[model samples]
Target: MTAKQDAQLTGVPSAAMTSLLPGPLVDDAWLAEHLDDPRLVVLDATALLPSPRHDGDHRSASGRPGWAERHLPGSRHADLTSDFSDPGAPCHFAVPTPEALSAALARLGVGEGSEVVAYDTGGGIWAARLWWMLRAISVPAAVLDGGLAAWQAAGRPLASGDTHPEPAVTPAVPVLRPRLWSGIEAVAAISRGEHPGVLVCALPPGGYDGSAPTRYSRRGHIPGSRSLPGRGLLDDTGRLLPRAELAARVGAVLGTADSPVVLYCGGGISAAGTALALTVLGRRDVSVYDGSLEEWSGDPARPLETGG
Candidate 1:
């Protein structure tokens, strides 16, 4: 095999490794070549966000049915809504306990030395959520840039129905990185201007400006947060923008790499997209508010404001 192909399969050093490795995003070509690597676990972490017009439980919206119909060959579906998140939490997309997360991942055949590649049918919003979950537990993971859309566009083969590998024997013990996530109390303090950091709302201008339809009790954003919609980071094909462009967009609000950034959206899903964007820009001091506006706006006590 050529050196490039070898690198793709084993992550061995090659000219292309410079751009592919030491990062959080990989393209469809890289994943396709490595699809059969024993040390790799490719997860279709597909979860559709509920439409604002549909007033129902957002937690019930899942991409499993679609995944069951078609997905990457040999890729197992990782249900973010049910398997990876806290279903009993007060709001949608709450982070599950490390133990719960570890067990769920183990059942998906993930273990030590496994290089995880997560992707979704849509833009990488849901896939990034799973990447963040793995990162929170200190696992080595990356999101498929452009996701399944790009894969299919590349004329890759697809497999349908369920495919289960043996459950992993090694337990996934999470290191419990508290700094990777922010809770409601921490967000409240940040909103109150008692904390030293920037609160970023990753929803669209409408949600941030209070002009959009909302499922939350309140229709606006956290009082002191700034608007930096996560979708703005992606291009027409659902792939992230060029590095220079991405840096410019995030830098406008973040100012410096040292700036502590707390990202949030309708729920935690999109915020993870922004978090992944920041990581791509080499910013380490970033955290996603897990409950996001779901818990914030639903509570009568939390403060929210509308308009830019």
Candidate 2:
């Protein structure tokens, strides 16, 4: 059957009827209460990010085994490195086409009406990527506030092994929000002073300053971009910081909430974490550079800078 037919059969609404929840982040208590709701779809969007010293081959370094071993009850696995990304792209985890994304979500029983709650074992990094992808398609979704760590800390039940529900139907026509992404051209423009926005590098300080071991074509970072590691947005326990603290830290780099912001990391994974933090902090005009340094550093024409 055609995607539209499948969507109609499964009760997936069209674009006009799509509605998002009030907040992008949900606490463990909120998720526990809604866990058994028929309309709710929980996804363990866990991924093991590539090490700085390794090339951008995330498929070989994924956390799928952990998901198979244990995950939140009734949650399905969403593989960011493979299933949800563009396999043909030059860099790892390139955003997939709307059709590809819709198919992946459908396989996980996520429809237009499905209220998705995405979480990860690696805190919020991978989960936020799924959340951002859902937003791109106008699907209503949220991230589990502290992910698996928080849920386990609360003594929640866990289920092992894989679970496959019947596929869900969503709108055949997916909404692609261009503004939500910054392409290489956009980054180049920003680099050459042809575009206006604050470029935020979401890697670690070592990665930002060229002191970290790297496997990219070049070391260093995009010149003029501020270094605000995505991990800094979270506490030692992996929970996000309080709103006041988040506002102050991000505000210090962004200057104003009205300023356009572009977030990028090694291969666009950690960047999503910062994007999620910004969303919780009430920043509206934020976008992720999909290629990030993976694409930037690989190009010989692009310039890189070292040191703070």
Top lDDT prediction, candidate number: 1
TM-scores for all candidates: the values are 0.90, 0.90
Please list the residue runs of candidate 1 whose C-alpha ends up more than 4 Å from where it truly belongs after superposition: 1-22, 54-59
What local lDDT does model 2 show for residue 308?
A: 90
Residue 179 in model 1: shift from native, Å? 0.4
For model 1, how does the per-residue alpha-carbon lDDT over 254-273 read when each residue is reduced to its tens digit? 77646588999988988999
Candidate 1, poorest ten consecutive residues by summed lDDT: 4-13
Q: Please list the C-alpha lDDT of all candidates, in the order they appear.
A: 0.82, 0.81
Output candidate 2 Cα RMSD. Answer: 5.6
Q: For candidate 2, lDDT tens digit of each residue in 49-102?
A: 547455333434566789989889889898887889999998888999988998
| Candidate 2 segments whose C-alpha is farther than 4 A from its true place | 1-22, 54-59, 168-172
